[model samples]
Target: MNAQAPHRQRKSWIIWSLVTMGLALFVGANAHLAYVAFASQPDCVSHSKGSGEAHDYRAAKSAC
Candidate 1:
């Protein structure tokens, strides 16, 4: 009925909005997952007693 048309359309819009948000979130979270946790390729060799090369500097390394 015409009286309920607006409500249906509003509900559809909300559903679409939520779907879009979820899709964006999923894509954003997975987009770079393959590059996470795994160490990056070492640029140069490191051979200190307890030294190692920087592996994808996600954070600063402290001196050991």
Candidate 2:
């Protein structure tokens, strides 16, 4: 019984390590995707045409 204990303990450690690594990877991926989604800016912009404060404005979407 004593001889088999070390092997069982090692197996358990490996399984737990793998589980922890998987969770970490999952969390990291989600964080990266969230950052990309929120940090990105819209390419569309509004431009003013004509002269003076009474100028007209035009809106267009960009290729971004």
Candidate 3:
């Protein structure tokens, strides 16, 4: 077959790299956001809102 054009080859490589990097960045950002949201979330409550926090350590969480 005839040789492919240089411009076409470079364009394909550029498009492929951009798509992969875009996916990587999107996933990385979402993971980071999830980590921060959960890790920094307010403690779970089991008091007035969580069984009225009867000083029950057995409570799944504490509040009030």
Candidate 4:
């Protein structure tokens, strides 16, 4: 079987290389998800109107 040893080794190397690549992709995706979960901020707008005791305030997409 010595004649086929090199071919078998090459196939094993290719499989391991693909497994490593898949692991790296999974890690990168999780890192991106964590970053977005922690680092994202809301973009919002607000408005306020007042006339003495008739004061009013409001914010878009949220309660003010």
Candidate number with greatest TM-score: 2
Instruction: For model 1, give the 10-residue run with minimal summed lDDT.
Output: 55-64
TM-score of each: 0.53, 0.65, 0.57, 0.64
- Global Cα lDDT for candidate 2: 0.80
Candidate 4 Cα errors over 4 Å, as ranges:
44-64
For candidate 4, lDDT tens digit of each residue in 1-64?
5899999999999999999999999999999999999898766545554444555654434643
Kindly indicate the candidate among 2 and 3 with the higher lDDT.
2
Pairs that collide, model 4 = none
TM-score of 4: 0.64
Candidate 1 stretches with Cα past 4 Å from truth are 37-64
Report the poorest 10 consecutive residues by lDDT, candidate 3.
55-64
In candidate 3, the residue pairs with backbone N, CA or C atoms under 3 Å apart (3 or more residues apart, or in different chains) clash, namely: 46-50, 47-50, 47-52, 47-53, 48-52
Which structure is stronger by TM-score: 1 or 4? 4
Off by over 4 Å in 2: 45-64
Give Cα-based local distance difference scores for all models: 0.70, 0.80, 0.77, 0.80
Per residue, candidate 1 scores C-alpha lDDT tens digits across 1-64 of 5899999999999999999999999998886775674645555544344435554332345333
Per-residue accuracy of model 2 over 31-63 as CA lDDT, tens digit each: 999999999986755565445565554434434
| Candidate 1 local distance difference test against the native | 0.70
The TM-score-based order of candidates, best leading, equals: 2, 4, 3, 1
How many clashes in each candidate? 0, 0, 5, 0
